[model samples]
Target: METALEKRYIDFDATGFSNEELLTIYKKLVLPRLIEEKMLILLRQGKITKWFSGWGQEGISVGCAYAMNEEEFILPMHRNLGVFTTRNVPLNRLFSQFQGKENGFTKGRDRSFHFGTIEHKLVGMISHLGPQLGIADGIALAAKVKKEQKTTLVFTGDGGASEGDFHEAVNVASVWDLPVIFAIENNQWGLSTPSREQFNCKQFIDKGIGYGIEGIQVNGNNVLDVIRTVRSIREKMLQDSKPVLLELMTFRMRGHEEASGTKYYPEGLQDEWKKQDPVDNYTLFLKEKGILTDALEKEIHDSIKHDIQKNFDLAQNEPLIPAAIETELNDIYAPFTQHVIAPKGDQKEMRFIDAIQDGLKQSMEKYPDLIIMGQDVAEYGGVFKVTEGFVDLFGKDRVRNTPICESAIVGVGLGLSIAGMKAVVEMQFADFVTCGFNQIVNNLAKLHWRWGENADVVVRMPTGANTAAGPFHSQSNEAWFFHTPGLKIVYPSTPEDAKGLLAAAIEDPNPVLFFEHKYLYRSLKAEVSTDYYTTEIGKARTVRQGTDLTIITYGLGVQWAEEYLDQHSEISAEVIDLRTLLPLDTEAVYAAVKKTGKVLVLHEDCMTGGIGGEIAALIAENCFEHLDAPVKRIASLDTPVPFAVPLEQQFLPKVRIDEAVKGILKY
Candidate 1:
């Protein structure tokens, strides 16, 4: 709760620095300010799209980066240009990032400060702002789990403090006792809103009291204060294995971005803050300390400006990202364990839930870097007890029970993935995925595609209806993440496929969403594989073959299709089970359509925007010449799962598949 400036570097010797280190600090503080100025010129010249100014806040960015070890990471925001420079990320590549050039870190995939390269140990921010805090928690977790001597620092603005992710992430970090420094640059304004309207607390650092972590406030305009404070708390954070929230108090001397002028600024406020400008203050201190002279200062300025102009000019003329399907879509997922592991033998009959648990268990045994986290997955054994007895087998360190913060946990998984850990996060129910959608869609889904950074994480989504669990608990929501490009979706029907595909999902390098139907958890049973095995993610299984018709389905739909055929044995049908949704097995689908000359698409999801629609389109577009009849889709009515048994039966797509099958035959 300490809000006052505990230490100030007034005199030259007060900073406790030799001349050489002081000069380095001065250079670091000056570089970002100059970069901002140069980027503004580029913006005005129509060379770049936009730029966020770090005009007065260089001290916080520079000092924190300078204080940390080279291997320790900083999840930075747009204004933390000093972080990239201090980390020695090549200047040419950094400028190319701004120019949307192929030579950039992200291969021109992202033009904003939204790219992270593991080589430099620097991950940038997403526009959402708050989720990165949890990612920092994961990075710290990796260092702790590996027993590496490292600490992680993350940056956020005053405005970012209000986001629910901030609360959730900080709490997760504190509860886990992670070695993280949550550095908040209190720059007095977020866009046009001042700090007065953001919060009523004495200062933002006091917000840390609820989490029971130490809070420190420093004068951000004084580079020495930022460096010293971060240095002072880092050991404490590491030794105690806890987080520290450091609030850097400063002013935004300019508008948020270059184009948005400070027209909303209070009169005379910018002028007053100008007096405490970090770059100017640091330069004056260095000059007075005899660490810098007029000639030396000019030499430093000339050197940096020359470096900036050379890099910027080269980046300006660099080749733009190619305009082609192959180049644009390449590297959506990093290389993974694609070779399937052959099963040893068939085990005794087991329920669908047991198969899922078996897959997760086998995955843990196979990969030592794997960690399983969810709401109750540890000692409590998850909501459905899917991970029951896992903590004792795997130990508590690996089987972690997470707080009910869906968004932050997902972000944490992403961090773990970046730090080279295979993370499995089980959502209590798939419907709660809405709470963490941004992290899945934006952070986990995009990182590998963005920079070839593997997101080796699996989100086990317990989905589907028919248990009368009502709207919240009984939603078949795999379709929600299906439309996104970077995520892999798997929906298995039989217990054997569930075990194999779940194993595949965990082994895959990209972020995979494994949707397990809640209705099938205990209702379905089969003889599953006894040994660890992985089914190819994008392949389809032809469960039943017939010449008369083709019925393509997955998950609960597979059971329904078979049940319909059982009731009416007259209809000869070939049922193809699409175990994976993302990389749909187009070849198998086309082959089935070609053979039957009629296709019926069935799924448990609602009619609109369902996987059925995509299957129908693929048939219509690819097999138009071979088909004798138009493709038909059967699905549940577009509504939330109902509470009443009668209503739930109507909402489920049981009888409709039979009707759709008969209708397709007549065509």
Candidate 2:
């Protein structure tokens, strides 16, 4: 347990680098800082709306930037602008992006330092901090699985260091010995909160000891020290296939943002930190060693000023992002095609779980880049044995068993998807998806519409009520995602639909939530087609047809509706199983409502804010004239699913579907 002061700093040798190389790195360090000052000018001039200054952290950014290969990735935060500048992101494009012009990387979808060019291996950061740390682990995992020698570098603030994602990513990276570096930019403050108030630990470097990874601290303002330490750590990570936690000690010299005044910081703190500024101090250090002369220094400053002025003026005159909503909607998902291999047999009888297993096997075989990950999914065969024997078939590299961190599992899956690999992630129980809800809703769901990027990821949720399993294990949470715009939700009841839809979801070019009914995993069996086929997403299929009444349902609700119709043979009830919930198959729903002239919507989820309400409304708007009776909805009670069998039975609305159907028929 060495204290921060007791720990020895690696003395960097100045003789290792010639004057030219040191000057180049210094030039890279100063450019972004100067540009940031120009941006502050733009902010005051009302040319740019907001700016997060990279004031004191240029040394860490530039040092880390120089350590990586041109092709290696640096998943950067807002303060790491030096990484972008070092990577040679065009001055005009970077300024244009800051000015919200159409020629930028995100095409004005994002104005702040919230965009990244995939080609440059510089993935952008979202407002939420730690999720990107997990994604960086996944990118490193992808490189390892593909046998590509690549290292991923991710930066996080001391505040973000306390986030759960940081722990999950470190745990995963350590367990797998991933090639990555978790660079904690310890700027002494997380927004207005001091580091001491955020964590009980004395230093962030010691936090890595609990996770069994190497930890090192560097003087962030010393560009030479940072560059030497990062270069050595990066080399070790690539050679040994282990992650490192490097803490860069520095301070935020300005407010968190231009608008956030420094009133919260201690008095004279900004001026005190300004004295140790990386750009200025490092320049003075270079001049002392005779590596940088005043004449040469002035030349660099003049050159940067001229360049910044030219780029800033050009950025303001560029075209703005298009105002068309249709274009934005169209870019929400990238187009993808799937190769289907028709089963030789007409159909084969199989359980719902087996059909899912078969679908995963087929997809993995067809697409070599397909990766399956979840808790106990590899050697343990998953909780329900759905992924049994997959590890032996695809090997441990492709079929991985992840820790119980649901958010990182999904976050990593999202990263893999963006890197052009298909990842099928399983949530042990759909009820626990709340742990990863942020990643699903904010990052995975919004990436496409936000930047025209496709997150080709499928999260297989083992959903619906399991008899006596209690609240946490037994929940149908599909309706919650229905309210979100950029997600596709799929719930299948039968073995055939399960196999086809799972395959479709794996190949679909969008982030999809595939809900599998837990009760039906083994109980339901049918002769599913062996051929490679996918039930089209966003389409509804009529399980049973009748003229007197129409019942639209999905998942276990479909089973309940069919059983009720069978018992009352003379009722003439039509049952429509909505395969995909998000793209509501309005045509199929409208046709059924018009023909029967009576409709009932049923689901296993709760009634309030349920998909049933959406369906009921869709019917009222479209088929109002043809309906003989008002469209009604039946769903579970608005309470947590109880553990007791009787209470659970009462909580679910399955039994009441029969009564609703009878009441509808009479109307």
Candidate 3:
């Protein structure tokens, strides 16, 4: 029972290829197939812990590689071992990663298919499937902006096509006319789930029509057909700068990994596909053309086996990864010099939003690779008009608008950063950041510590409740990322600090969440420096000095405490504005607590699990002996923000801070 795909591949014409080229393609297919078998053997022998076979799908990957320019980027999934081999990733290094050797790409910090060399422009796959597609879009976007003629080919399984990232990435590419090919290797099974179970489309390629992109399908096992189709797509992409959906229809001939069996598949399904095994069929095709004689075939097979064996031996002897992973985790953020340029003349007075826009303009002018992306950040100038003139100044390529997909914005930013470009992504509203929380907490925050790569991105979030925007729009969500390590949190309260901190964040080599209070966007006015300077991250500013009680706050709380102190002249308080939350200024906090002997932590976030507790705990731990009174925390009630103006005001615990300050002074 030959399937339509198998019959199509069996009759595929190699009309354009010369005899020598046919033989070369045959050898390319055989090498990965042999490497796949060797990897399975190593998995069984405990030399490797896991194995993913690309045994039946080599034709698609190899053929695509054959048709691609070496300069084009490839974001490949785990099953595309042929892409690695084709890109000249030495077999010894591949085996070294598999065996968890120190000589591997990630110094054995990563395993399985998680490996790549920047020189080859191939980003190794992450466990999360759909994000790489978005990453590919970012890479292609970068290429387009830089006036490079390269394209990006990103692959995913049939199951991954259903991911939100797939929709987001393709849509962005279509609208932007980016040179990214969405290559879906439809190998019929995702783990144990069949393609039919994963998607309802007649073909995965059919969905591209809705995205306004050209769609093409080819038999996965036909090397010539795959190469020919991909070459055409690449040419079309170069000419029009539009993306194409290339679906390679094939079947997985083995279980997801070596430890699993194919029992879930129909009994004869494996044997049937093996009859059309790409490597064997291609070899037969070459033989029929008289390009592959028995002697030449034996020589080619022996040469590949010897190469794998040599690499296997080197891998077995390579130094084992250290018992502790801490040694290899240094240089999380790449070092860069910092300098402050003097103000050109008398400092100019500006609102917080203007300061932000100026800071972005300066940073982009300095760093050519820096990109700013968000939902209305481009031609429309953003909903808040914070980036009103940016598109005019930097063009839409650099300051681009995105669809209202918060997660995809962050996800694409992560990709751009990984590809060695700096990105600043804006979440139009701070509360809406939850939509892309996974990329922030999971991907961006973990990359540097896990694999010693910088996730250099600045996520600008317009935060806090002041416009009476109600529950969904008004949230101080810094606490969510405060709990996440390896992320720098910057919440600036003044125009001076906003401009300086944003400049520093742009220069910093790690991921930073820049929290811009929506309340202070136009309200706060100050003399901002026209020249560039970076207010140091992890430092606090003493807004007001007092000795009666220490009041620690940030964002909107800073204004509340200042207003309260201005009214009540008798009660003295030391007001500390924590610009960065993750790296708290313990020295400033300790000195304040010691001088006042009483502490009150004030914030607008919900009371139970807010950053106030962390500050209170810090005061109790390090400044406990200096404290003459107990540490008190004043925060909003544990309820969603209501729409009523009075209720929202009272719900934010603004007036309560005054009461806590008075109570702490009395104690």
- Report clashes for each candidate as comma-separated counts: 1, 4, 0
What TM-score should be assigned to candidate 2? Answer: 0.96
By TM-score, is 1 or 3 better?
1
Candidate 3 ranges beyond 4 A from true positions: 1-9, 323-331, 340-344, 418-420
Off by over 4 Å in 2: 1-13, 337-346
Residue lDDT tens for model 1, 313-344:
88888876777787656677776658988667
Most accurate candidate by lDDT: 1
Number of the predicted model whose TM-score against the real structure is largest = 1
> Lowest summed-lDDT stretch of 10 residues in model 1?
1-10
Runs off by more than 4 Å, candidate 1: 1-13
How accurate locally is residue 213 in candidate 1, as Cα lDDT from 0 to 100?
A: 89
TM-score (all chains, Cα) for each model: 0.97, 0.96, 0.94
Ranking by TM-score: 1, 2, 3
User: How many backbone clashes can be found in candidate 3?
Assistant: 0
C-alpha local distance difference test of each model: 0.87, 0.85, 0.84
